[model samples]
Target: MTGRPGGAGTDIGLISLDEAGARAAARVAPVPGVLELPLVEADGRVLAEAVVARVDLPPFANSAVDGYAVRFADLRPGAETRLPVLGRTAAGDPVGTLGRGAWRIFTGAPVPDGADTVVMQEDVTLSGDEVILPSQSRLGANLRRAGEDVARGQEVLPAGRRLRPRDLGLLAALGLERVRVRHRPRVALFSTGDELTEPGRPLKPAAIYDANRAMLRALLARAGADVVDLGILRDEPTDLERHLREAAGACDLIVTSGGVSVGDADHVKAALSACGSLDLWRVAIKPGKPIAIGEAAGTPFIGLPGNPVAVFVGFVFVAWPLLARLAGATAEAPVVFPAKAGFHHRKKAGRREFLRVTLERRDDGAVIARKHPGEGAASLASLAQSDGLVVLAEELEQLEEGSTVPFLPYAGLLG
Candidate 1:
């Protein structure tokens, strides 16, 4: 028997976090639907197909600065040359060929034909009807060429890419009004245990407000999933079975918190068995171990541990990859950077651990990861007060002060 909180047995060998993530990703299929959305509403959605450039970026040759456009041959070598200023051209104005003269051009204005160089206004002296250019100006300097940024008919974006704000700007520059994107995965979410009470309700003896459902809803929303909140479910076996059946029928995936352990009150496994199938995975990870991965009525299901911090870790590390694949998006890995440990501590062997830590730049020009004072998995304040997590691999038995460790910032994980 394993010495976990619920006294469950680890008959299945402990799965590595990476292997568990891959298994979870392989269990579900992408949601089978697509929709065309305007560019304004397509941010955070996944592209359904590859997009090709319809027109060249910039679409024409223009000036890179507010300056004078002149031909390279007009400048004299080793001496300053004066050229007559013919006319002024602003952005979107018509251009005329240069005839042994220079044209005053503003930023983004088209360069005149037969002109091959632009001299910045600050670099040249402006005399009446003439501009004095320096003796050393390279041909084609400060002039933007057409089709330099992106050529027409080139594939600008690939399939399964998540659209960002800047991606919308790119598509807009290509003159695309709408794009086809994968529909958001519909997720049915709920919390278990008779002791869970909704927030703002009267708290009875031995009951806490249901924080997991609300937190999970927001997390799923941020991951681009349409959530179907099924509220808190009691421990009754028959009621749990009914709810799972309904959720499986209506949603692409089912997510639940708690009730997956071996205790008598924990009934998620039995409920899933009645409706479909369940596999209890004891992953070799700290704070979260007993994860339920299965399918209910042919729809995928993921049961996370009840602890708040455990839920956060399981969702970020395990469930997110599955969600990403189901949404038809390219998998994004969290960036990990190195930092020195500020404190020394021994950890349990054979399990990966993530400690909430705040970073400080030392006088020696090294960043140090300081572990939070509280190490409990239920400590929400520790999560809020800390910057991110410092990961310790399963092989690491102890961490020494001043040792380099990998740090994962919240910005990198959440974004």
Candidate 2:
């Protein structure tokens, strides 16, 4: 297979996944519009600007435990000292100035004036308003200094960062009621295959349920895109062309699975050619070789494979980055970790392969990866049974048992 047919104005050819990704990212712009949302509803939203500290965290120096605040000089080793109880202070309560030879404090309560240290109540004996400090107590052992947790005017969060539940709590601690976040990218999804059927309906002999549409929608939502389902289309050039035009006009990006193959019934290519331009069609990757990329009505269009696993891989390897770039995200390659191979594996030399494998913890605390039983791109169960993908570089054809190989954990991206 090759990339989509080039337009009359420009020449297009098959490119690697990296080059295609760069071109797609360069062609697409970030989603427009920003909205101020309450911190309570801001989870999973990317920040449009940096979050600075409105006030110091903790706000004031308070007691870390229920104890008495006193002058360190009053408690010396082997020296007996008795200080008068200068009243009491509880959380959110104020205690007047600490007179000489007296102490006052409590848990979470502000330290009284002129007191520099706190001694736990368990370490001292109290008898009728008089407190006796142990001779071995250290000076200033339990004081929580003001501005220790967060300083005033500090930049707590930077722009372009996605907010999590914990991040919202941090903003709450800083007393921010609202935040500014980037607009979510609008993604339009559709599928093409006369043999495809929805799950609820009974299937005919040559029909299969359209799983790629649902799967890609979930993945795109996880990547922070506002997905609009364009449903499935028949294998007709006119119908496919109409949907492609509508999707392009309605959404920032258009994604579809199937109908980009070389077979005669595959009308997606012709439809794209009729509408606008299809720039790329194929990539140098296994399982997802028949990928299609182009622009229709100035909206980016990504065509994935028909196989379930291939659709997902293509989404992760292609569509996900495109969506992230459109959402104003600073895209970075996923991190890979080294693991030992539990079994030998073989592949071709020119095409990159992502083998599904289950990683087991060995006795030595190292991870050993074993390939799944079935390697077909249509086997969705194989992905469910595996932990991650063991990437084989284009030049490598064989890997021996116990050889160290780089792998990417599915947990990193999906979780």
Candidate 3:
């Protein structure tokens, strides 16, 4: 037996949320190798190879402003110097050298030879076939040097980085048609509960739709896993055994929502223990206290709680990072920033808590977290209505209004 004293009798002990996360991270081995993808298709893929740039960004000395390109030495002090506008130079148009004169140049246009600076159109008055240059315009003013944005041979995208849309665009600009990225991990996902039914089916008199299945599947897929949904299962010993074995064989990671708690109907705990190794952890966190981690049929399994919010907590805090690691990515923790509390809050001292909160940007630029009135762990609506969560440490019994606390925004977690 392994668990906390109040829960299912188990040899495993109650661990803090931090310990649970670190433990989950320690258990995963990143999948090896890579696959080449076209630049447009590489968005959201983890880079397996460092991308070195072949050429300097911009690739030429260009104008940073839509004005005139000229020689800095031609202007005299305290007086405006007039020069002929020999020709117009637009972006991608290269002009001949400027000899004691000016050329009308649009933004990004290459600066002609002998031209040391650019002057904004607003700084000088344009006369017919000529422009007035200010004597005060300094050398190199408004000039965009070649390779200013990126230098050739620089590491543009480092290895183990998850590529974003901007990365894709940068790689495209660098003329890399293909990029090598790690293959997504295949995950087996399911939910276990005798009282649950699938949505869109006629509801049984006493059963609820298995929301965890859909939710977990979505979370896994969004985290870059190839999801193999195993659907809902009963607490029956034989059924759990069969599915657990099958999932272990087919998936790189296995996840189940329900049947890992202290209840007598916890067939997931029993099945995992009998099939292989199991450590049912009692994590010291609210909404989700009972969680399990182990191996079955040589595959890793993470068992989360049945409550909708608990499932969310476990997936966000553990399973997502586990998947990222297995997919050859460095799983960075979600950023928690200091935010002022708009209302007073209190909780028991033994466990950590995450409360749903809406953030308001104060006039002074301080972020304020307004907690949801309903604090129920099972209140899924609270999670839906709030923008982020205000994290309370285990020893924090109460937080007063206007006090600083850490807030984890949903935008960072959902991605």
Query: lDDT scores for all predictions?
Result: 0.89, 0.83, 0.84
Candidate 1 lDDT, 192-286, residue by residue in tens? 99999999999999999998888899889888899999999999989999999999999999999999877899998899999988765578888
Which lDDT tens digits does candidate 3 get at residues 63-134?
999999988888877789999987788998766688878988899888998888999999999888889988
Candidate 3 lDDT trough over 10 residues, lowest sum: 1-10
State the number of backbone clashes in model 3: 6
Global Cα lDDT for candidate 1: 0.89
Q: Put down candidate 2 lDDT per residue, 245-323, tens digits, no spaces.
A: 9988889999999998799998898998899888888876777888888987788888888888888788888887888
Segments in model 3 whose C-alpha atoms lie over 4 Å from true places: 1-12, 361-366
Give the top-scoring candidate (lDDT).
1
Deviation from native of the Cα of residue 137 in model 2, angstroms:
5.7
Candidate number with the higher lDDT (1 or 3) = 1
Which candidate do you rate higher for lDDT, 1 or 2? 1
The C-alpha RMSD of each candidate to the native structure, in angstroms, is 3.7, 5.5, 4.1
Counting clashing residue pairs in each candidate, in order, gives 0, 4, 6
